[model samples]
Target chain A: MIIVETKNLSKVYNPDTVPVHALRDVNITIEKGEFTSIVGPSGSGKTTLLNMLGGLDKPTSGEVMVNGEKITGMKDSRLIDFRLKNIGFVFQHYNLIPVFTARENVSFIMLLQNRDKNEMMKRTDALLEQVGLGDRKDARPKEMSGGQQQRVAVARALASEPKFILADEPTANLDSNSAMNLLDIMERMNREEGVTFIFSTHDQRVIDRARRVIKMVDGAIAEDTLISVEAANQ
Target chain B: MKTLLTIAWRNIWRHPARSGVLIAAVVAGLWAGVVTVGVLNGMMDQRLNNLIESELTHIQVHHPEFLDEGYSRLFIEKVDEIAAFLKQDERVKAFTKRTITDGMLQSPVKTSGVRIRGIDSESETRTTNFHTNMMEGEYLDSSIPNAVIIGRTMANEHNMELGHRVVLTFEDVSNQLTSSAFNIVGIFESAGTDFDRRNVFVRSSDISSILYDKAVFHEIAIMLHDEPFAQSLAADINQNFSGITAQTWRELSPELNLIVEFGEVMLYLIMLIIMAALAFGILNTMLMALFERMREIGMLISIGMSRTRVFLMIMLEAIVLTLTGAAAGILLAIFSIRYLSSAGVNLERFAAGIAELGWDHMIYPIMSTPEYVTVVIMVIVITLLASLYPAAKAIRINPLEAAKDS
Candidate 1:
């Protein structure tokens, strides 16, 4: 079943003076358990599409229906609530609170939800261990490496128990080894837990690992293609 | 709220040196303001106390016509009855009747106009304690005929001394001129040089014998244990007596009262000025804090922290900064006030300005509990007001743009 769908989504920046078409008439859908990557060259609307899909930016013209509910028309305040409850985001940089420890960072979303303390702690510990930073739970963002901090961000994104996560170039700042390890862990989580993820990236490594790749040109989708297991292995 | 405070509290320490400097500035500002105002308040209090003790008693009564310059038109009727009434009133701690007249005071070589007060010496001493401040000879030896006590300034200006007889010329009640040679039996020096020069005291019986057809008085000065009740007592006296005007110390010395009130206004003004300076320091620091953490703030909002919560967090940060600093400052001030109040700050070095103003050369810093509490409350209020600018700046930021700032 499709967990996310967008219909004819468009976004324009500085529309009155110097209109920049960031996204145009984008139509896309992602199903549960799919590992998707939205890929494009520079200034090709990949990140804008992700932003529209995540409800961080309102589309100038069209609908973003996640789980069959239109979120594009929601107020900014209600959009925040919707994002907190039903969606997660991982930015290019780690974006972990510099003052919060790794475990606290992971637990922040649950804290926003005002969840039970013991339950939140248990889930946070499990998420940290799953990200392979179990022993580094007390480490602050500044005290951790780029890869470690991104893992913390991932754990944070998952803490709200959202239906899907949108990662915007999650490994852009990582070294090659850290990038591979982070992609491997995300892929494993996608396969084992059926946690849907759609990320925007220019990285070929991320595009190679995605079960499906959506390519963009200018501001609209140019190609949407699925990779078979055998073809992906080849 | 807990989440907001946690973030705020931690954010303050993110740059310990910067936050510490802000706190230190707050501490130093409050300390200087409180101590300076306290010392000024002490000086004003001393000035008032000296005025009341050495000269103006708490309440004074005069025949309405008697406030003019010469003794010819000034004399209170029914003096014995008024004196009897004052002696019976429990609120009247002490009272003295004076027969006052402006006259030419003739020394051996020079002459000066003076206000001659005919006083029952013992009663005058009880009312003003001028006897204690007498610097030479004796306080009106009634045994010596026509004995007089002159102030130091008048004695110095005239080159007069003890046992030097000066002829005083004035108008009697019949409008006839009279003169008498009264021996200077004592000399007294007081805080006010002008007051010392203008006033000279003589035995009431001696002057009244020549000036009045019957026993009478020009004024009645009343002292009280509760100085604040002076106005009420004066009102009572005025109402009870048909032809007299009873005035409180404040009414008699309006300019002095104005100066004391102005001193109070100056205390608040000082607080406002200090707070204004400190407010800018805090605003600059907190704004810098918010600017530096724009990405983090954007991340928080993007993840769903409400703008109200963000606003509250920034405000909490400002409050913590001010409260911490002001509390430390007030504590430090309390300690120093206690020490300086007991040990006293000697202003003999500022004798020309302070001592010449008729206050003692030493001042004890004075801040009552209510005043200290007022200072603390004012600081907290000013800090809350100061936070509005920075908190609005924090909340007005667009998360999308801020997150993209990189």
Candidate 2:
């Protein structure tokens, strides 16, 4: 059930002028339907690992395979197509398109997939309703609260039924109450819908809710721990 | 594609004040460009039309030797048949025959060299504006012996009034120097003072008796319903008629043709410069907007929108911006031009200067549909060209760098 695997992956920025190792020989695997968190302090390469795992950036050296298909050697255009069918992303600042209404934001990915209108509408409505923005479907991102925008981003990510969703510091900007509400919804989806998710976060709230925790120090994995059975029963 | 266009359209309004300023600039630029070119073109057309109507009729037929100064031998024969043919021709609006001779007019105070025309009063007025140009006295009368007309400028120069007698000296058919005295019955001043002072008119009967038979003429001027068909008509006349040459107004007055060509080139050049300025404004605005949304655009790329679609979105935004502005400009231009065209833009204040170019005191501004279509197409092309640099920049943005907090 492994959805994404990275072996001996490394990324170096400005190698010739001033070499800075962002991620060094990192190895990781993410299984389907698993809610996991990749935790590290600033500059510890959590973002770099997530970027390569999602095919958003190329590793300086190594292999990245999603659903058993190697993506490291794929052409940029083909990688984009592959990512559309296999991966979704959520940013820290709730990067939902500012011009589109909440419903339009959710329907965007389905439109890219060329989904049928009726089915796309049904799915968009269902996702927005699940994210508790059903009544706020026509509201634009600027009109929504920070937490609501993030929920719309989550709904948009799910619109294409991507195999896994990668979220970078997803709750870093939310207040305590909004943070808890967002985490509650995400945890509920993780349990009920069996949607695979991976997060790069410094937020303890997201870390506490996730069933698996992958910790990194100095661009290398220091720990990988699973507590789904224990966390689910709690 | 529909989704991309909708997103592009909405994106432009993200900064409504900024986009509004850009659109307003485009609208103002186009309005000014169209109106200026329209008025200038109107002036040129009016000048040409007046030349055709008041001075040079559409086509003129002359004896091969008529251009030289020998007035005795340069006369067209078979005149009655030519006049009859012209009357039966459907394209001929009017025609007049004249006997021309170079002579000197002597008054008590002074004298001047002039081309003396012997015009049949009835047919003369039909082909040209001679009847309407009379400022005093009357048009030529065959009944009054030795009756003549002189231009107002010439009369003023000689300090002569109506009923003043002037002397004309010219050669007879036998090349004999003949002299006669005539009464100035009318004084007329048309568009230009220079043209008026250099010519005089008299009844063809008064002068022709000394040169040839009463019916002989040196020149035949013809006016046509459709001015553009003059060249073809002249060709037909030249091929069928014998012992005569036919020439169009364009051939006779090459300066007028030159003005028309020059005016059109200047108009297009002015429009091109304005559109280029408007294009720069669009490029600056779109580039700023794209740069502001670099991370969002990066996120869009990460979320699987193709680079081509991203490029198209930015270009679409530019096109939509120009189309809205250009549409508004066209509306404003149409309304203002239509109003001014009916009311007329008077040039009487500039008449003295305008008259030098044979232009009238009033001009009507006009723009044809093809000119409007050209403006629209040119605006769109300018906008599309402007979008290239920014679109290329948008596609080159790296998602990883944009997503990182600096």
Candidate 3:
């Protein structure tokens, strides 16, 4: 089933003085459990599209339907609640609260949801192990490597059990080895846990691993491609 | 709520130096405010006690015309009856009759105008605690014929010593001027220099013999066991008695009343000024914290922390910070006040100035519980008010823009 769909979405910045069209009539759909990537050069509206889909930014004129609920005109307070329950976000710099430990960083989203304590702890431990940081649960972000922190961020994004996670340049800050390690964890989670992820990246590694790719040039989609299982494996 | 509190509590310590400075400012401000109020309160209490116990007593009665016009003929007619009633009254702790007359005191070199109080020494001492203030000689010794007690200030000004003789001249009951010679047997000092300089005490027999055909009293001062009963007892005296007017100490000394009333207002004004300064320090610190943590706050909001939660988080941070400082300050102030209350703070260097203003030079600092509670409430109110702009700024952060900027 289509878990997310956007229709005729557009965004304009400073429309009164000097209008900048960040997104122009963009449309996209993602099925449940799909791993997809939107790739483009800088300032090509990749992040804006992700923001629109995640309900982080308002579209100039369009509708965003997630799990058959229209969220385009939702109030800020309600939209935040919707985002919390349905969509997860991973920013370029691993924004794990610097003060929270690895386990606290992972379980913090569940805590915001007011989840049961025992369940939060259990899930946090399991997710940390899944991200291969089970032993570093007590370490704070500052004590961890970039790859480990990003893995923790991914665990945090999944802790909310969102329909889809929007990752903006998840590997941009990592070296080749750390970036591959992060991608391996994310790909494994996508394959085994049926977790859906949509990434905006210039990194070829992430684009290669994605099952589907949508290319944008100058605020509009230039190409959309679906790679077969054989091609993805290759 | 727990998660919010945890985040808020951790957030304040992120910049230890900045938070420490804000906390120190709050501590110093509240300490200074509370201690200053305590000192003023102590001074006011001491002054009030001195006025009531040593000078005004609780209530006083006078012939209706005696206070308005200082005519020697306008004496209370039923002095014996009023004294009898006061002696039997349950509320009256002590009472005394005085024959007061405006006169001139001649000390060989200088003659100054004075209010001479003719009193029975035993009753006067019990009623006004007057004998405790004697600085040099005996109080109203009847054996020394025409003996008088003068204030230290008056004696100093006139360069008179104990055993010196002075002459008092005033109008007699028949409107004829009369003069009597008295020996200065005592020199006493009181809190008020003005009171000391203007008043002289003499034996009732000597002054009355020269001024009246028969014995007459001008003033009846009554000391009560309970000070709160002064007004009601004064009212009762006025209602029960004829031809005499009764006045409470508050009525007799309206300036003291004004000081008591205005002192409370001044206390709050001082607290407000201190709190306002503390508020600015808190506001500045919180604003800086907000600006520095913009992206983190944005992330929290984007992850589903409500705007109200964000606001509460910032507010809690400020409260925690301020309350920590306020607790320390209050403890410090309480300890200091207690110590000073027991040890007393001597203003001997300013004794002359303080005495001129009718206050004792040695003050014992005091602060009541309600005042401390008021200070605590003020701290909370100031913290909430000061955190508004910063908390609002944190909630207004756009997650999208913040994330983009990051």
The top-ranked prediction according to TM-score is: 3
What does candidate 1's lDDT look like per residue over B1-406, in tens digits? 7777787788888999999999999999999999998888888887787788766889888888676555555677767777888888888889888888888899878988888888887888789877777899998855999998898878989999998999998888877889999999999977667777888889888888889766668889999988888988898888888887889989889988997898889789999999999999888998899888888888878887778888898899999988889999999988988898988889879765654456777898888898889899899888888899988988877767533737
Pairs in steric clash, model 3: none
TM-score of each: 0.92, 0.93, 0.97
Number of clashing residue pairs in every model? 0, 0, 0
Cα misplacement distance, residue A226 of candidate 2 (Å) = 1.7
What are the runs in model 3 whose C-alpha is more than 4 Å off?
none
Top candidate when judged by lDDT against the true structure: 3
Error of 2 at B207 (Å): 3.2
DockQ-based ranking, best first?
Answer: 3, 2, 1
Candidate 1 ranges with C-alpha deviation above 4 Å: A228-234, B69-73, B87-90, B129-132, B135-145, B160-165, B175-177
The positional error of residue B231 in candidate 3, measured at the CA in angstroms, is 2.0
Report lDDT (Cα) of residue B125, candidate 3. 80
Cα lDDT tens digits, model 2, A124-217, are: 9999999999999999998999999999989998898999999999899889888888887777787899889999998988888888999988
If ranked by TM-score, best first, what sequence of candidates would result?
A: 3, 2, 1
What DockQ, on C-alphas, does every prediction get? Answer: 0.62, 0.72, 0.74
Where model 2 places Cα greater than 4 Å from the true spot, the runs are: A232-234, B68-72, B78-81, B169-178
